[model samples]
Target chain A: MTGRTIRIGAGAGYSGDRIEPAVELAEQGKLDYLVFECLAERTIALAQARRRADPEQGFDLLLDERMRAVLPACRANGVRIVTNMGAANPASAARAIVRIARELGMAGLKVAAVIGDDVLDQIREQPRSLSEHDGTTADLGDSVVSANAYLGMAPIVEALAGGADVVVTGRVGDPALFLGPLAYEFGWSADDWDILGRGTVIGHLLECAGQLTGGYFADPGVKDVPDLARLGFPLAEVSPDGSALLTKVPGSGGRLSVACCKEQLLYEILDPGAYLQADVVADFRTVRFEMAGPDRVRVTGGSGRARPDMLKVSIGYQDGFIGEGQISYAGLGAVARGRLALDIVRDRLAITGIDAEDLQYELIGLDAVDRTGRTGIEPREVRARAVGRSRSAYAAGRIGAEVEALYTNGPSGGGGAVASVRQVLAVTSVLLPRDRVAPAVLYEVA
Target chain B: MLLRDLAHVRTGDKGDISQISVILYDIENYALLADRLSVEVIRRHLCALPIFSGERYELPELGALNFVLRGALSGGVTRSLALDAHGKTLGAQLLDIEIISIS
Candidate 1:
């Protein structure tokens, strides 16, 4: 029997977000669905590298851990699972889940995977300039790693309609993950733009999970949120009309208030009158929220225009590798020592011909984050950091090695020197003709 | 008085654009905030920043002002060398803007 009101919990916001809160929400929130919006901009590039190494892999790093933690509670509570944890590979992720269900001895757990977001090969054939930039995918050329289009809600709802217990996907729009359950439960029409717009609003609210529940919203004493240590994940009590009461589980740590909601409502948003997503162009300009009670706020007044004709594709490429090293200098003449360390690294890079595409020599305690070059007093200690993004890992490794050599090379009290290098995968967006992208869904039961 | 005394702030970024929302606690303060937080004023206030341009959008119903700062994050979180690459700290940077009461 379908419940009149569907409550879906936002299990995880980013890929590495806490798993314990998801367990708490699934076991106690009485949710019909738990959605995990895990993929971030550069994460897919890393996933692509995984797929290159092993075809059986290419899902979120925390997928197995998160699924293991949440599956028992969800299955026992009759809650369904939905996530974009599939990363670069939905099929493998689905098979993994099916296998996991068998291992857990929960037979007949239906799992569905939505595919076709990866369009790198197709994009390569027809290279075009990115959104606002002059460069095409061709310019990125052979360095191109992975290409994925942000999909909408239709495929997810299709999977849910087929009686799947869990839905795993790759590169669906963040809001589309949450909107799927609402459309599935409320039986909302696919073309119901206003309802979709309202659903989009809730999806945006719950997309980041803890953010709406005061995770990033807290300011101690000034704008206080209680019990933030054990902050609760968000669950929307969504109704048929595409409106919902935004709240969290009782006794949860974080505060759910209009102040918090307002911030998240506009978070990462540009042109509030027209928030273009895969499904609809949601308008939150007229959005209003009122507290129904403590931690209970009713959100309403969102409308929609037509969806965009093109879908945004996140194109990840091997931008090169970043090498970084840091060394600390303390006591008198620390500022001078830090300056000397930076100068040495600079000179070393110049002498070594490590012509990095981008290089930074920062006196960390002074001008690292703030570019103002303001040091109130010559800090008692300052850390000199040298970083460079270069074409090769070998070149990237040298920037730090050059900095570490400063210890024996002598700049006075150069201690705690460390160096490391890692491949850098950069991301940029390009619009693809939506019709050219064919998203498909398949279901399997273990 | 500090902008924080009158309003709460949130910051978001897209590519190089830093989107900031200044939401007032009281609906009445919208007028004062609207009058005070102008494009020129904000541009000048944040002139010390590495950003290139600023544009503002007002939502009076929600008692909020949305400011989109272009070239703010250098190249954004993925590639920017800034520690706060996403420009998440821009809100606190913005809250530092003082709004003297006309009264």
Candidate 2:
């Protein structure tokens, strides 16, 4: 048995996450790997839109800035990179990384791009039943923009084994991004369900980066987290046995405690026992955490079952346009005036013969956040907002136009009127047979 | 006293479903939370939403209650017209549930 432990750092949780924290981890964390999980549910679909317009530009918009900022430090510290910033185009993203590395004067950087997650043609051919919605892909029809299956950690493990310094992939499972390194470093086999499950727990805890380090844990008096502006991302020191010590950089902002870990454990999860991932059905129900030090927590006791037979696919379709407008009112009777403004817009939208499918009117300061009806408190200020969705952009535009007209038409003390309309590239899910998604990896040397 | 006094909640969303985990600051409060905080109780508390259904899962050792609400986000973040489309503030709102007659 080896007494060695690998230190892994989570750089960014989402695509547009702050880059400074990642740079800090690369330079100062003394880590073996730095992983960035950038894609959200709808991000890849949006990226597909960009790709259709221009093939070379479907990757993350911030990939250039992120690579330039972190590459130098990562090269110096011998820290490898794993990320899903590839979005809709992993090959293009990998090529871009090589170009950035050459420009940074770091030559011979082995970059691997994992492709074949794009299952658009396959999904179109099969027209499988949607996982969440009632209908199948056929119901979506021509409005379907993109479809990518959630790839597993196998291609990533292969990429690392091939001596790739950076592994960029498209739509793989989020936890699998972190699990790849663990599987490679520990030599965990495909059938090692227990170890993989525990590793997945570590991955889930670290995937969101700053969330484990108190990014969202602050309250005025309760759960107060200091220096949120410079919040440090999370890192895990995992042994071959699957136990991990979760902590953050010393002298960094944010708190790393058991409370924060517990919150992240259940984030976006439905069944605690059955967190169905691409590689395994991880059971986090038995997971436990303890305070190891001032900014360290020891995690243990998570297990898993075998992998699923089917792979989940994210399908993005053109779901019409949404238009919204907002106007603020302040001073005495601000709530009343805001309410009146919303009422006028509501009536105006109806009077204008708006062809909106759905409409919502809200008083921002009073009931916007909770959606639990009016709070009934007359605050000093309020913003009236009107939003609607329609099949036609012109019809959606009318919803906002009615609210903007309220400045000259109705409601006293109205100010800061703004309106806009945009296309909604909405996303849904479908299940595909595992064999359908044949993941392939391509390497680029810089 | 309100539930916020004894616990903290974190809200997460996937599609139209919202997941809120209510974690007690102390494990001693686990029994109280588990006994009083039922799916029916939470459904009643959040009656204003267009929620189709809800399910509650309890983690005793962790002193947490995980609630999954279907049809809560009004079509989730990508489609919802809500100012806070992800329903990120739903955790804070759940904290407003008053834990009555705790002696």
Candidate 3:
């Protein structure tokens, strides 16, 4: 049964995705492996910085909560777990999981830790001008927060092969979490490009836990999804050759349709023919998604190419500080008052010689970030917002303070004044020689 | 009418780039979106934003068009000071674009 097909359930999509559905999958989905992909582009960097601050930290914030919620159920059902929730500190996370398993009386549970993605020192050794063409890459100095490479499925497959009840990883490609178990159970060779490619396409679909099951596909009347409050996460039934049936926990809320499957297949892929990852270049050009049954889609015809020689690294650095202030205007001429409020803050920054590196002023309801939602008509109320960026947090705080001062000194009808200042952890991409970095694994049997 | 009238959107992000997929409910609208959602048209429609370059890859079998908008994230999720760091709303913004029906 394990050789021919394996059932895998997506537990959590991101670090903070809903977990109740994952518990449902563990209790009822009959999954062989439950994969939780909780890492994002910036999450690992933030996690690494957190680890630097203190030991026994730097894991996913909800790690303990998620494990406590689902570990007992998963152990009772004999369902193994594979996850990239270790974030910046896989060892610490693995140690904690060992403690949790012992506490839950499942002392035999084996958790594997995959590490060596961190390469900040390596990045600083060979500094070069960033390749991002945007103006934002300028003025990036010596303050780097974290540098971690996007690891592949090699170490994870090793853990699964070594009889690990749970595989913990940090900074792996999203699809790698799913592909590792698929590769291990199916015994597909690492160099098997076609199977790996097909597996990656499935991993991509399942990576964003509830996306394929209709969590993000709902609209009021145009694209309606029913009972979304009880939306179920996705699970895949894969054959040895990488052909799979995508479905969800039966009786769950969301609808699984061709639209959801197709959108997910194309999500985050730059070129369908050349979706580059550390393991293989997944090609989705010839893939197909057909309705196999109700709430089930059959996926097939995926292939891959040779792996890239260079691996992309996401580097996090202390970029700057952001200061923001918002004040709401209500009454007959709220739009005008909101507009005037923004003007006052913009002029106040200049008049006070606050040389903020970048500044933006917006009428909240009319325009937020881009020139979006700008209709000719005016609403009864609008919030005026001003954001300033600077090298110093104090200077950034001053920009927001100036806007707050208008609450008492000026801007009639202004209420709900708020201001905030926060440090920015900026991210950048650089290519590292693939051979220069390696993924190593450690196992802890409770 | 708006693109959202005929299709739904899904978003993904990579550094400074934002990828939005416009998937039509009915496969019949594939030709319409393929014909209308061109580089020049999208560039012109999204001129207000700081888009350095745009690439459109069409999947006829899936009935979808994937747009990779470089420099769309206002720098990036962590780097950008924008409230919506990941440019999660770009797909909604694209859906709001006026589509001249190919009927």
Candidate 4:
């Protein structure tokens, strides 16, 4: 083990669900590095829509206020912070961080913004005749909500190497935050795939903070832990040989257990034998986890192969319009009545010559078996629902109007009440190979 | 069927679905329980009526027996509702399973 150990502190709880307790742990631990990850598909769409409405409102700026409250305590204890909370806009996020650092009177603080993962503009720049691989002509009929490329750790590593205390990035791989620190500390090159892969795994393990440290463990009985409202997040003390010990802040709530570690290990990964990321392919099966102490699980004996040549690109497009409405049914045969009401509405729409592209109907609260041919007695009440798509919003609205009419015309209409309809923006996604989205296409906006 | 019998149960809709996670301790024990009770036993004892039209089976990856039910509500009365079949079953089915576990 090297004396200059590479310690990694993972920041979690950004779903606004568990962030407060997670943040408290970071402040109390006096950690070397703090990382917060806050990105999801739907979140990207929402952020993009906000950016379109106002360029400055893209990223999750709410974190700024939260971070501001903690920055003083973190600075006082000399802890550095890194986060992907930048979301769609990194420079803007960095600017906010800079202001906070200055306000805190932290001298010699360097804030770096890692950008260039968004490729929405590039996708548009291509000739209008370009196809989407399946021979379907590319069409931007509706507004483009979001377009972000998933980048690796190079930019973040560069930011850290340039002496930046806080690194803010947009749409970076979750593991990149953890990998960036290792690369900067060990002087690992971009192509040094082996160590980079190990570092990526370390990042993946620690990304969710308390997750590996026992936040969602089935065993070790986490429910019995005291003060879960103030649970501490996990941090890894990684060695040069790619070995790591997982532990949380002292005096924290959760306990580190083998079951919790395994649960997190199995979360999003599709294949344990081939865990693919932009940097490396880590083999989780070869990796071993041992409970070292009270809140410490030692991670070791992991191996890696090579990375896939093509990077997985997430492309979103406009599919069509969708709308939905719900109605409630009560009393005898409630489940059957709900289903009958749905059929009545569909039959009414068909008779009215409504040409919806597709239609779906469901009866909730019905004592109905699943696709496996299981059945049960009808419930006392059931919620009937339907969904469909059309070429225009007007066509979609027609479906909603018809559903409302059913309250008076359908069998269950005597008692059933129709809820207001909701219209959804249509979105679809496709994957393009790495070669299609070349690095030259990416650029930083001043 | 006991909660432990549902070591792996996948519940989702046509294309997109959210995870309704249930962790079980033993796979073999759960499989044996599933074989004895099947979906019929679950519905009779648990009061969870199957909603979808197609045949549902167990998916090992989800670590739970999965049933892909169709025509379930998308939280609305129109076919354009965002609620999928699997999501509609969550409330009644999960409660039924919980009752079975306690019993």
Instruction: Give all candidate RMSDs, comma-separated.
Output: 2.0, 1.2, 2.2, 6.5
DockQ of each: 0.62, 0.79, 0.65, 0.12
Error of 4 at A154 (Å): 0.6
* Model 3 score (lDDT): 0.85
What shift in Å separates residue A34 of candidate 2 from its native position after superposition? Answer: 0.2
- Per-residue lDDT value at A303 in model 3: 92
Q: Return the candidate ranking by lDDT, descending.
A: 2, 1, 3, 4
Q: In model 4, how large is the Cα lDDT of residue A67?
A: 75
Q: Compared with the true structure, what per-residue lDDT tens digits does model 2 show for residues A380-420?
A: 99899999999999999988788888889978879999999
Q: Show model 2 residue runs off by greater than 4 Å.
A: A374-376, B101-103
CAPRI verdict (incorrect, acceptable, medium, high) for model 3: medium
Q: Which stretches in model 3 have alpha-carbon errors above 4 Å?
A: A1-3, A133-141, A369-374, B101-103
Q: What is the Cα-based TM-score of model 1?
A: 0.96
Please, what are the lDDT tens digits per residue for candidate 4 over residues A274-348? 678777787665556777888788877655677667555444444456656667878877777778878987887
Tens-digit per-residue lDDT, A134-202, candidate 3: 332234556777788899999999998888999999998889999999988888898998889999999
Segments of candidate 4 deviating more than 4 angstroms: A13-17, A103-108, A127-133, A136-144, A209-231, A250-255, A367-373, A398-446, B1-103
Deviation in angstroms for A193 in model 1?
1.5
**Deviation in Å, model 3, residue B28 alpha carbon:** 3.2
Q: Candidate 4, A47: how far from true, in Å?
A: 1.9
Model 4, A219: alpha-carbon shift in Å?
Answer: 11
TM-score of chain A as modeled in candidate 3: 0.96
| Chain A TM-score values, per prediction | 0.96, 0.98, 0.96, 0.83
